[model samples]
Target: MTAVVSNSTEYLLGQSLSSRDDDNHNIYTNLLYLDTSSPGFNDPITFPKDPKERENLLELPGNRKVLIAQPAVVTDVGDNIRHYTLDCHGFQYVNHTTKCSKEMFLDETMIKASYYPEVDQLIKDVTGASYVHLFDYAARGPLNGDDGDPKINRPVKSVHCDQSYEGAKRVVMSRLPDKAFAEEVVENRRFQIMNIWRPLEPIYKDPFAVTDARSIPDSDLVALPVIAGDYTEESWAAEPNSAHRWYFKFAQKPDEVLMFKCFDLVRKRMSPVEYFMLRLRTGLKSICPHDKALRSELVWFTVNSSSNQIHDRYL
Candidate 1:
């Protein structure tokens, strides 16, 4: 497949907002793709089930971007086989509990002080990461616009990848100030870059959607270096392509959780840099859209807190 950069220009005049304007009543569709050459990318792997990988040796590092995905399934995503290799699929829907009030998630302090442990355990339970150190959390994605709704956290409608392999390590390092302890933990065990997304209220207007890692070609991903507040990191963005498939469930209730992987030790790791670009959904919105008194944004990184595994940093 030939990967082509959709436009010669990479800048945009206005920021695009995310909405259900492109929904079709069918709630499903198959997207087409015309491939071309992408600057830098390689070592594409299949997901959780098939650990096989296809490499493009022509692609180089320091300027590479790759995409990963998992196809849609109506069955419950919580019952996954842990013994299988997670190379083919990059995302999953797990049933989890936040144990925090809607208000607590909205407040950063309340989340760290009271709800951090629950998330810590969730990561441990699912990924088998004996010890997790959470360096940061965001009340990402605006959940609602109702009276008390904190709408500042609007969703980034543009498709872009933020967490890179190095960024994932930085996240771990940020949590563990003791460099020696961090090295010991990561070296001994595998860690994953995962995120937890849920709705605070019954969702209404704009809901979240993700591209299946399967939809993206390894060459199609463009990596770029990012300067976050305190650290410089690497991230991913997809150049526009039709072959890319995007999916979202109808009316994801508050009880369900969307768990997706970004980078993992088990997968091929590469260092690359490219600007962010992604295939945007172009179509119609759903016919039976619900009313949104408000939408609640519930999301955070998952990790475990095991003091014995490393040093006594928590102490």
Candidate 2:
């Protein structure tokens, strides 16, 4: 299939927001090309087997909306094209009591702390966002990471600190509907992304819905970079060769690539410049009323000691 950006500008703007076709949903879908040779490649791999399977597991109701999702080419992990299972969950230890594990919880803390003035200021003092935007700093993504391979099924553990991270913090915003009808809509798009990961139940014909889609803002979903790994084993260096189940790992092609897939609307929430810089270390200068270089209004940092990686993400 042609790369998403290869399509015409007109096609992009007119692209359907509702989940219907893979072409339309490709925007946010993980880019992992499946390796059919792997066992259970055609079947869904369930571990703890989430009852809901994953929340709002489908599209939401709304008027037609348009967002741009451009394809970006970056250097691969190495020489070989590492194949990865898209959307595998990665967990990390923060405090003795509060262990942050899932993607939903991680996204929530990022949105609360990263978007606030105080946290933004701290980021500014470290990274110069004007030039280099941090796309996904030390924040975690939706359960993405190499836990090993489905062929080996090795259990892993990990511990992390904030200093050894590279990605930037990003704030994601979505106006997708939250009604019963939204489930069907999302499922339609999910099919386009990956039939491997779907809700346990079929779409709810009369599910409850959220009326205010705009209530959730981009800053409400923030994340940072991290050096994550299992303590018992070498998380980054080990090969994923489990016996039967599928786990996160790169293809053996030498170029280790991370596989990811998401819906069209989900793609839009993550592809912006401002959202990219929230996680990097940038240098910030106190605003001078007369300075015209400030891209936004001068806002003071709000100190938030309540914030900690206890619930932060580093995927």
Candidate 1, residues 44-149, lDDT tens digits: the string is: 3111212121123113233233332212211112223221122345554455656777867667778788777776766666555655656555554432223233
Candidate 1, residue 139: the lDDT equals: 54
- Please write out the lDDT profile of model 2 over residues 1-315, one tens digit for every residue: 011111112322112222223432112111112233444332321222242332222222211112222221111122221221121111111111112222322243543444333333332332222111121222211122223322111111111111111111111111122344334333221111100111112211110000011222222221212112211111011111111111111111111111121111221225543222122111100000110010111112111111112222212
Candidate 1 stretches greater than 4 Å from native: 1-88, 141-151, 185-188, 267-315
Q: Give per-candidate clash totals.
A: 37, 64
Error (Å) of candidate 2 at residue 219 is: 37
Indicate which candidate wins on TM-score: 1
Candidate 2: worst 10 consecutive residues by lDDT?
Answer: 283-292
Q: List CA RMSD, all candidates.
A: 13.8, 22.9
